[model samples]
Target: MAREVFDLSFSNGFARTLHERALGDIEQDYPWQSLEPSRYPPLLLARARVGWTENAFNEFCTAAAMGQMLQALVQARAPLDLIGMASRFAIDEVLHIELCARMAMRLGGGAPIHYDPEDIVFALDPSLTPLERSNELVVRLCCVGEALSFPLLSGAMRSASHPLSRSILETIVRDEAHHGKFGFLYLDWIRAELRPAERDRLGKAARQTLDAYRSLWERGPSHVVAGVTSEGFLLEHVRELGWMEASAYAELARVTIEESVRAPLARAGIML
Candidate 1:
């Protein structure tokens, strides 16, 4: 992000309500008793320094994406239930920020987060209606991003050797399931409002999003396995941490994209 970023203190009443209600039943969870951060070798420690920083960055982006969705919801003149969902999703992202940030601390801390609020939300795309614009972003962020996140996180949880890491990953997987559904719900509710051309645009966008996320797995710094595992200190480091093998990790991402993202999107008429 450039410079501007969100400030919850200044949020509108509706946004505030969503935050309060969603967090009302929630309590922070940390596996303090299970943590053994010091036992991790240098590679996993580097994973901590670099990996946690990347996690924090993604969380920051998630928060901004949610903020954008909230604005789009209001502009789209959505019904109450969907609006409430949008509000709740915003809160979810904020909590995730806290969770990820602390996880980084547990991993031995990471780079400081910096973001521009302007960069957080989507800029208005003049070619589409308010509703269509909202749908497009939801398709990318919630539909593709959050939807795929579930399986990816679940795989990570399964691969995690540490109890505390599993706990944290589990919590994230739990939260992300709902977020993944939020896109489908929003799209379902507003299908009638969308033009055929708009749906095509969304379909195209969804495909692009799939490709983008797949690229991350195949090539993105954090998810890519080949970069570190091709033969070097990083490879030895990863093995010592008992982290999932790169082949396994990359395969998990690929399968999730094909089945979880592509198939479900086809069912939703957002064919990718």
Candidate 2:
């Protein structure tokens, strides 16, 4: 498959107007002018740009996944309230994508990334029943993925010294607060109908998603932020620019997986 450039854009006229209304004053008073890009080394800025670009791409993928979840819920005849909540989350992800992309531009410019457009997300298995498929989707996307991200984002937010960086992380964390718990809430509503075998399968699915994320953080160090000396003091400015050090990032990943993901998943009867 040919790799295509990963990029983002928006339409003009009424479409954009409608998007703005849904987003609601997204860029207003964001402390954008406070960014001191000059203080960081060029290499660090370039890395930050790539990091944010990766964030934007991941958000786009999540939005696509949300669409799949929303459709699955509706097909399964889920409660109207759950469907409505999923609808809202899809838009929230779009806003996040824009925010992350803009942050990349703020650092310098978004780094070039190539991806197979055909493979944006893990496709829902068609062999399963509607409700069963919904369960798998929720477990993977919300129970594991979003649950893992919430605390990691919080850690980055805490480490961010730059006001603009902190503000962006704060906004993302706020929007995603519900996402982390969405899986458990769905399970609470639907668990009575789930059989032991189905629960076991969902647990495996959750583990697959968890392992996917693990592979990312464990892929050694990023080329741009590769070296982490014993002191690790040189990356302090980079952290203010909205990145955790490699070690701190991996540690937090472990913490969130244990406390946030595994604990709740076991309670929900999908132990992994």
**Which is the leading candidate under TM-score?**
2
lDDT (10s digit) by residue, model 1, range 1-272: 36643222326689767765765523344565456567656665766656656665677778778888888888988888888877877666666665666666666766555566566555656877778778888898888999898888777777776656666677777888988888888878877777677778888888877776665468433443554655343553453333556667778888888888888777777677
User: Looking at model 1, which ten-residue stretch has the lowest summed lDDT?
Assistant: 1-10
Q: Name the candidate that leads on lDDT.
A: 2
lDDT at 184 for candidate 2? Answer: 83
- Model 2 lDDT per residue over 1-272, tens place: 97999888777889999999878776784877788788877877777888999999999989989888888899999888888877788888998898899889888889998998667867767799989888888898999999999999999998888889898899899989888778788988998888999989998999888988876457464433344434343666867888777667877888889999999999888889
Off by over 4 Å in 1: 1-28, 112-117, 219-243
Error of 1 at 85 (Å): 1.7
Clashing pairs in 2: none
Model 1 error, position 93 (Å): 1.7
Model 2 superposed RMSD (Cα) = 3.0
